[model samples]
Target: MTHNPDFKDGAAYIGGEFVPIGEAKISVLDWGFTRSDAVYDVVHVKDGRFFRLDDHLARFERSMARRRIELAEDRQALKDILVRCVQLAGLTDSYVAMVASRGRPRVKGSRKPSDCANHLVAYAIPWIDVIPLEVQERGAKLLISDHPRVADEAVDPTVKNYQWSDLTSGLFDANDEGFDTAVLCDGRGMVTEGPGFNVFAVIGGGLVTPERGCLHGITRQSVIDICGKEGIVCRAGDLPRADLETAEEVFLCTTAGGIMPIAQVGERVIEAGAPGPVTRRVMASYTAMHEDAAYVTFVDTPTRFAAAE
Candidate 1:
């Protein structure tokens, strides 16, 4: 397939065909659109290779299973589609997303979720940073938002769904207050996560992140692995807002931005407004892993396509 100039910015897959990202569309009635009944996952392609492709796909599958959304494409088909999107977009570094949406109910006006068909929609666009590069350089300023995260019971945090009212509201609050981003708590005063990233804190010489009320982010796992390999103590459990406030260092992790150090949380400054020693070490390790064969899937390799076939 020849590359289209319209797709130079982005490309998408929908209904078994590829199109320019702008041309991609879904029915307004699709539950995924109207009711936000969808589960999605993102995997970054850097330097023409996909980072932790298998892990991202596995998580995507798990999310779909949890939401009871099934599409006709299997794992291999999904991978091929995602690769094609990046190829069509001609992007060396791209942010790729695979989504499973609960389509409009076959029987009009049916409220039953089981009556709706499910399908996959995917796209690849330019690489994105949840926190801009310049902000990451000096470290981000965050707000402890007043809006609390939706309880895990109401909407499973483990499943990557489109339920973001609380997160978006918090982000608005942060921006309005002149902060770069925001993190929501569990109402009980336990820190949860930011809009698109997981929170981490270094306190008393150990690393701790909230074990609940947050998405189990791939980058968060990478940080945990890096800590283990580097012999730094890391644990996941209740991370109270007060404890986070007193942390010697703080950071956020996500697929889009990797490891981002925090310079300040609310009015308190961390590590004198800079990326701390441990945060810098982990960031370096995360960057290095992008080149590791064990963690990457090259995008242009015909062998990968053949294997998927």
Candidate 2:
């Protein structure tokens, strides 16, 4: 992003203006910044446009409800802000991020109802390719964590938030232990999810994942959609630790990271010791689908909230 002396020297979007991220201003006393009490979403961009835009926005809205935070901007407005940010950054196939927080004043009388926010941030990174090239080349390894994923009833994992202190501990342990990623299970000892992704298994002659507890990752859903078209039987049910160890294939699904195949589970080697056939097919299908997706772009002509202006 071009540096502007007028802004704080960091590239960011504040209210409806583009400024350096550092220059972008918000209240330190704003409950949103002070409290990690916020909800957010990131939309995967393909070919300079967002994929499943509506679906992502719906999740953001639901997350706001879950956090008891009102959306600072509505659906159409959010899209406009994202497009402007992406255009400014010159990103193609990037991620559009949004965060909404509780509108509270840091000081008692500084309160402003307009301080509620659906703050925006944007960046582009290479396709996460599900499996890292290094891991895929050497065969992926996992260090199962004793870390417990929060139960859906206690706190829904689907609500994307900043409270990642739990996952960070597991990731640190996994890093020291020389593992690619960390895994977590629900209160029932059933595999709930990974630190930032969804888990899948090839068992009972069908593909399976834990139902509803983990983030309803759009990536996982797309893979399931491909399975039907490609004649791969699929299932969603409880996934126990032993079930994964004994399964024919294991992998993870996420938006930024697509389909990551699990080659080594703990010290035991999985079958074939590489990306499995099902994961491969799904990955290829997803790539083709997005590369040829229909995009909705924001027209260059400006749209105005005439009353506010």
Candidate 3:
């Protein structure tokens, strides 16, 4: 790995220090890493600001409560961690991830004889530029996976837990099927979402996204909010595989990935080969909102510092 003067992939923060990716370690026996026992949240940075931090934190708290992973750092602490990570990376454009996992239950790394059931891991990385759609260009394709999404009973849909072998498996299944992503269904054979992102469709100029009992996407809510602002009718409900072919526009949303347009499903094409007018408008509007966020506050430096150096 090219350890740029500043960035490293496996490099991360733990116990308040920046360490080499190889040196910073977790246990083979730790519940978090070993069994994928944990939760995580990601915040997107555009023009040096985190989009919907409060909303992300709210969902994060919900994730924590879902698995009962106790943490010493609460909301304010989370906010501080987010800022510190961004500052450490010295990145003005990129995505930052804040992850908290259930600590090893066997009392391996802690002095407290009682037991440590959770741990917190946080880091930041400069993200690759998001691919934007060119007008009339065909969007990526998706394949329907025979495997369904993780059951709601095995894990609550809201928590961004680390137990994602099932999700990854779905992606692999899709790749093997020669598609870009995996469209997962519920036990009822109803389409839920693309492994990590929310599923959305445009049916007759109305914005339709799935309601979250399976995946609660912050970006999905942003899109819905943008639709409301632009005077487009919007709905959040179940969308089936059958509805995809007839839809006017279809897209996926996530923190790192902005709105992504889907060009085709199976042998059928969406309304156009590329992004529609509505998707373009929402993406533009969301960009404007990012500009007005708190982190965009003015920056100033001492004028004479360079002369002293």
Which one is best on lDDT? 1
Off by over 4 Å in 3: 1-11, 20-22, 106-114, 128-138, 294-309
* lDDT of every predicted structure (CA atoms): 0.91, 0.69, 0.68
lDDT of 3 by residue, 1-309 (tens): 124435444335565555544455677767676667678888776666677888888888888887677787778766666666565565676677777776666654664423765777777677642333442245867666777777778777778866666667878986787767767777766667776687777887787776643568888787878887889898887777677657787777777777777777656676555577777777788677677644242112121212232
Steric clash pairs (candidate 3): 103-117, 103-118
Clashes of 1: 0
User: In model 1, which range of ten residues has the least summed lDDT?
Assistant: 300-309
In candidate 1, the residue pairs with backbone N, CA or C atoms under 3 Å apart (3 or more residues apart, or in different chains) clash, namely none
Please give the TM-score that candidate 3 achieves against the real structure: 0.84
Candidate 1 has an lDDT of 0.91
Deviation (Å) of 156 in candidate 2: 1.6
Better of 2 and 3 by TM-score: 3
Winner on TM-score between 1 and 3 is 1
The lDDT of model 2 is: 0.69
Superposed by TM-score, candidate 2 places the C-alpha of residue 3 at a distance from the truth, in angstroms, of: 8.2
